[model samples]
Target chain A: MPELLPFAVSLKGTENAVRDGLAQAMACLAPLHLNTDDAGTVELVLAEALNNVVEHALASTPELTAIEIRGSHGADGLHITVIDCGAPMPDGTAPLAKTPNLDVETHDMPEGGFGWYLIHTLATDVKYSRVGAANHLSLQLPVGV
Target chain B: MELTSSTEHGLQIVTVQEPRIDAAVALAFKDRMRDTTEGGIDTVVLDLNHVQFIDSSGLGAIVAAMKNLAPDRKLILAGLTPTVDKVFRLTRMDSVFGVFPTVEAALTKLRA
Candidate 1:
């Protein structure tokens, strides 16, 4: 299926690059005519995906250092694909979503591990694959559906 | 992220002036929040009315800030935009933190 108004950007796989990728992705999403709520959804989901690349994939393979984000809006909804020539997913599978221990004691609350949880919960049609030495992740978010 | 703080009803309210809080500023945000919130009232309310977006890192930063307060102080979040609020709810952090729609509401609750 052909994508509507496709946009893509490539940068180093680092935290700063995730920031830049988010900005560029926002620019790409500008013309998609998304409502404010949908835009915010895409932004949050995209940030989580990109930041995962920076923190896990990129951290593992500093030598394999290119992160590419490609996205488009179409009849289905907003679709995003993040490609990184960095580390593959552990066990070659997307991490299972674990509900954080929300009912913990005051002193035992968790400070992290919410990234994949939000990504899985917010985005639809989420997928991850390892192609050779590259990691490919794709996510879709509906526009006012 | 630019943050401002004030005291209301014996609770410290800190407002985040930035629209987005993500990996880019999570560390800086935590450090600055620690500094701004250090040595104030035992209870603090984070005002995020201006923050329209937050990622896992930003959420973790807020949690980290809260944990940094430790056994002595408390951290609450207020004025979360719908998007930010959704993230919190989806991640179940809403159950972990006391979230209010407005700073005044949080202050009122804390006072009572």
Candidate 2:
């Protein structure tokens, strides 16, 4: 632990609160000289993560779930960790995003496969861990930038 | 997030004046865009100046909206913060939608 700042927030993952919490985190982290976008990026990623927890992670069980985000700075890079107290992913799901359709092909049904895609695209590094029914996601960024 | 749209020289500029559009609000975003397009607007310029974060669901919703308007109308994205830009680039969405430095720039190009 290289002097990390931890933030813990509990909410219904109602989208708006997740958005605000992400903004608040960015405001606190980006000022450290990590060039982060003040736009829909955070909202998109956090929304997906929070939603997964709210819908599938806890399966609407209302287990008094909470998300813990941690940020730290060091000579290596900027570290962001999101921890959710919920169920593990279905069998073998990981943090990596699915393959994107790059051929500009038309779709019969225009839905699915965009959220994690955007998250994987924006985050320099992402890692997911399931520890005894907990989803621990960490996103990192280069500090030199 | 509430989406407000107005025309600028025949261009439909949709502005989302809320903080975030994560998964919970992603469907609302798509619904609003659908309503905006169904209202007879063709060209769209999505303004994300007020947004700070966009999770996977949020990004998916944006792409979904663009697809919904495809082969008929076009969608242009504007006012992407550094994080937002990174997301697009990483997901290769930089190629999916026309991105602009500002809304005015996107409109200018569309008019040209």
Candidate 3:
């Protein structure tokens, strides 16, 4: 008998709780025998997405914030789904992929706004949808490829 | 994040003693960097040789630390792991800062 493929975790969407979520996700991934780089990719992508939800989406409604993280192994690689009942993307629009403005002088270098860029770059097949009150984000990473 | 600082060839080298610079310690890392770099030399080299991971929050903290420095001061990075290096390159932050292969290289550039 083998274990399950898709495992889900429901947690309070708070910045403080992200570490625990990441740990749990890693634990679930431990059996998959992902290499260091692949594992890091998983961790970083998940962290960025979860942090975005906690920081931006759940910023105001901290009381009703609930984040669900689910991971399943697919033929391509590992698949992650993050569902959160937080604020929709401002103006009812999904976030588009935009590169950070790096063409700046030393004095004009940016301090933040690198989160989504990293998320979009590192994860493959990233999709975001605002479903009713929940934001559903799907991302995948191919292992050893 | 824990850091140890020293002055070498007129450049301040701050070594991050932690392995990961994620959201948990990004703020504290920035604060310590500010305190360390305040009223110091104009050029600072951050040693990330020990750091194997850096998320966007960590990157932002580094950028903030750079901004918090006194006028004309620069923050340079050195000894990035492959994973961490990719993060910088992917976000194109590599273009904004001078990233060296080693602390020595960063210092030599400063010295030269």
Best candidate according to TM-score: 1
Instruction: Please tell me which model should have the higher lDDT, number 2 or number 3.
Output: 3
Q: Going through the candidates in order, what fraction of the true interface contacts does each contain?
A: 0.80, 0.55, 0.65
lDDT per residue as tens, model 3, A50-74: 9889888999886587899988876
Query: Which CAPRI quality tier does the interface of model 2 achieve?
Result: acceptable
In candidate 2, position A23 carries an lDDT of 60
Superposed Cα deviation of residue B39, candidate 2 (Å): 3.7
RMSD of each: 2.4, 3.8, 2.5
Model 2 ranges with Cα > 4 A deviation: A1-14, A27-33, A37-48, A92-95, A108-111, A115-127, A138-140
Ranking according to TM-score, highest score first: 1, 3, 2
Best by DockQ: 1
User: Could you tell me every candidate's TM-score relative to the true structure?
Assistant: 0.91, 0.76, 0.89
lDDT of 3: 0.83
Q: Give the residue spans of candidate 3 off by over 4 A.
A: A1-4, A91-93
Q: Give, for candidate 1 chain A, the lowest lDDT window spanning 10 residues.
A: A1-10
Candidate no. 1 TM-score: 0.91
- How well is each residue in A113-140 modelled by candidate 1, as lDDT tens digits? 8887878877878889998888889998
